[model samples]
Target: MNLEDSTALQFDTPYMVIDFNQSLKNMKKVQSFADQHGKTLRPHSKTHKIPLFSKRQISLGAVGVCVQKVSEAEVMFDGGVEDILISNEVVTGIKTDRIADLASRGCRIKVAVDSEVGMSSLNESAREVGKEIDVIIDVDLGMDRCGILPDDFPGFLKKSSGYSNLTVYGIMAYDGNVADESRSERSRKVASEVETLTKLCKDYERINGEPQTVSVGATSTYDLWAEYDIITELQPGTYVYYDRRTTEYGASTMDEIAMGVVGTVMSKTHSNHAVIDAGYKSTSIDNGRYPILIMPSGDTAPVTSMSEEHTVCSDANQLKIGDRVLLLPSHACTTTDQWDKAAIFGLNEKPGTIEIKGRGMRE
Candidate 1:
């Protein structure tokens, strides 16, 4: 059976591959969006985990890339990605030292902070290295995750400013909970978020001088939030390789998704179920969602469940052993972390392998 990405079909089973052309298109589209809005594009690289992909984002006009951990920042820098923002908290001394070392070596590293401990440690590290580190105040718009709450942010910012080695230049207000599915509702919720972010930026400015940047948005709400002028940087991750979850959120179409796991059918033990050679270890089962299966015949199959090494399709009667299938992710970011390399094709140039340089770099 012939498929559109015939270049990837010949690869061994249970590997990740991307339609390079689609990936580039996605990059260019988002870059154009940022450029037209006068916003700086700093895509979060935690989705792809590959430094090469982060560099490609920079090449496509992204000001820089955002990473979640110090190791990812180091990987990006080592792989020739010049600028990085560790858009998450890093409080440990070892990690903070690593980040300071990167900044001292001219990596142009910045980090997001929600607590004074993060501030103290990073500042101390930068002091030891005799360098300054840019920091973004991470505020919780509603995600209830790592950011400081809106009510306590002014107090926190007052406490967060004593670090002479750290400069608070931006605000990282992630509205991950603003996903309402409806476009109008999404826009309304994002407008509320923008209002809150604008207030937070003013608070930051009042205490810490001028807030140079206001970073926000995910792939689901990037377009909606881009309409606002207060947002200066976009941190959308999954837009690089949108998945089933992104499609479910109306952020992208199934045809526009560029990444998938190529797995070969290994068993059809039951009449109604077919087991593929990939599972949660190969793809990702994040958010309790399984990958969507695409059979060799170019038809879609429903993935019922996945374990460590096997993905089972409960309604896969048309599939058989030896057939190759593409497993499109439900959540692209976590799914991308499962692989160490990707075979990219369809760029109109030579199809080749790209090392997933930041894969498994959780530190």
Candidate 2:
């Protein structure tokens, strides 16, 4: 049989591989932590972008999945994800209408808004669908990315309050600014933001006469943020597949690092230097974080540089010709998006596969 047709054939350079056991463990552990803390776990599906992963997440007690785009939401809806939150700003027109259609199909849809345009678009779509859509006012806690200023939150909320067709649920303050390197510092910074934002949630309730659901923090600081007295929901995407940068976040141990790209060492040029078939195309090169290499002996190293079809590892002296290496990416989401599907590997059973159905479903 040809290599492509052969089940045991050597894969050409540059393919993505995911360890099923590691990925599942990451999902289970995070969900369990959320359950223990009484916070609803709504993982960002933008990480996996796979319906199978979404199904597994829901089965593990995730309240719902959070998606960044309408296209992603549509994919999740078809994948049997009954609930979704479009966590980013979705403008009016076709996309907003798409959101309405998904809701019409029995998918519970909630969206985040920060500007008058965003609120108007969401409200317009909701009214057209003749449904009361749940809305979360995204607050600019610190990221300065895309959220209404804290001082302007009330005015922003006022715009949506009167719309019976649009239910102002709460606020989503994503503290993506906090660096996870120093645990104490991460907790301190995240707590400060959470304190200020939770107060805003309380203040919103004071004015609106209803409790607000304040969602905050991320996977790196989920442990600290979840324990806080305020947050109602937790959105941690990378926790589904702990990556190199995240492992350094002190969020998970090496044993907990569950995702890697399996590649064969194509050349052993010299001592302590080997070239792997997987490269920048197969794995992500974020520049800020390093790619980890797991040797066949179960030991691991780091890739010094990554090109299109080649990854150079200076510490791979022990690695020999034809040895398969597993690479833990610097960024899990970006790296996983490079693949068409992930080969699920395990020790006992035949490797399974799942299509990355929405890999580039950016539309």
Candidate 3:
């Protein structure tokens, strides 16, 4: 349905809405950036979490998709994606077995391992399933998250060599901390991290032969890392649905934001404030800010506060009961995880629903 159609309000408020045309533009724009730089595009499926959109990304030139968990990988594989990378560590036995099961079922699945225990667990699980699993070594480049220390990476690789059921595919690093910095600052930080990554890859080659893939880069560093020949792949998920964070970080513009929360003004009792149906439960507050309100009249307002079911807007006095307002989340990835389905609309096609196949796949 046309966005302007009154019938569009039939759907309940606090629902995720995507501009299909803008999403297509976003997909192609990032894909083109990857293509121009001769880097493989493996857009992370965690942002959209929908198989349809992942397939669309593949159609546009993504080599495959990246997922953080085994369940998310299973959802994507079941949805017809052949090649998948679990970009995070899978430590639990059940999760590892699930990955092995997916591999045995003919899915080309690869997972990241940062510790010997993780690698051993995955190897044992794969052995139980009678299948070999490809793995990428996750090197910690200052994030201090889920990766082996750069200096200790060589030892980890050496230890991984003993796992017969695991095939070491390559190396992966995530620079999530640098995503919010200025472009130049982000580039500098990424370059410094890449130096460490490059050294680790070289050390890996010295110990384990040529590493097949040197995967790195998130949405914030996609363009920055694309200029480096060492990085073989780019794993950006948020670029598909640019949010206020991306726009503020200079990675994208407000006009390029494709996803929004459609919330209706529920109360306007105060002159300078109003309440919207969407709140911390509907949109994420991980960025320490509330979602921005895109008024129908092309104006904007800052969400002052959020409760479980209500978002207080600072300048929503123009809104009345039943007036719809679009909310651009501060962080798209977490906001997306809050939804079960997304209402998709395009310039030529009517609105439709796409299930968030990988929603709540935190396991």
**What Cα-based lDDT does every candidate model obtain?**
0.85, 0.79, 0.87
For model 3, what is the alpha-carbon lDDT of residue 134?
94
Supply candidate 3's per-residue lDDT for 273. Answer: 88
In model 2, the runs with Cα more than 4 Å from the true position are 1-13, 270-272, 346-349
Candidate 2 minimal-lDDT segment of 10 residues: 1-10
Q: Which is superior by lDDT, 2 or 3? A: 3
Query: Candidates sorted by TM-score, descending order?
Result: 3, 1, 2
Model 3 CA deviation exceeding 4 Å by range: 1-9
Which has the higher lDDT value, candidate number 1 or candidate number 2?
1
RMSD of each: 1.9, 3.7, 1.8
True lDDT of residue 342, candidate 1: 81
Q: Which model scores highest in TM-score?
A: 3
Model 3, span 76-107: residue lDDT tens: 99999989999998888888889989999999
Report the C-alpha displacement of residue 323, candidate 1, in angstroms: 0.8
